[model samples]
Target: MNSDQEHYIQWQKKEEERWEALCGRCGACCGAFDKDPCVHLSRDELKKYYCTIYENCFGIKKTVNGNDIVCGSIRTILHSHWPGDDCCGYKKALKEKN
Candidate 1:
């Protein structure tokens, strides 16, 4: 692969790790509070929340209860309101410094 491709791979890996770290596994944004959650939502034995299809999670997806909704990068929802969002590390970091 070219240097550019290698750089992009490294960047993407870093970005994904950053995104993973930002979540507290609180599950509110996944529809936990609405009595329905995305079908892709899964939990380990410890009950930590995660997306089953995380790599392809962006786009229109259905809730476990079958409600259709759009999914996008967290950046898109940064300004929106949702449950458990208060636990978002990225949002907390922004709020604390401003």
Candidate 2:
């Protein structure tokens, strides 16, 4: 719309990109190390993990074993424990920030 609105939108996009960039794509959050990863989690040729339905990942989903899971922001589970969480980039960033 206006110049200020445009600038704000651009800044918001940059922030979102920065946040997304923190992910190492290890898929631990999706249950990779737990041996029951999300059904949409896929590994690339480089051995990195990614979500097949990333654009619409938030909400109810399923695990490889057919377990129902509630998907949401990584921030929501930051304080919780996962199998490979010690290698999580976001947790490392927060640790460094503090």
lDDT of each: 0.81, 0.94
TM-score of each model, in listed order: 0.76, 0.92
Task: Kindly list the per-residue Cα lDDT of model 2 for residues 40-69, writing each as its tens digit.
Answer: 999999999999999999999999899987
Candidate 2 structure lDDT: 0.94
RMSD per candidate (Å) reads: 2.8, 1.1
Spell out the clash pairs found in candidate 1.
none
Pull out the clashing pairs in model 2: none
Expressed as tens digits, the lDDT of each residue in 1-98 for candidate 1 is: 99999999999999889877877877777787677788888888998888888888888899977898677877778778887678777678668878
Best by lDDT: 2
Mark the regions of model 2 whose C-alpha exceeds 4 Å error after superposition.
Answer: none
Error of 1 at 33 (Å): 1.9
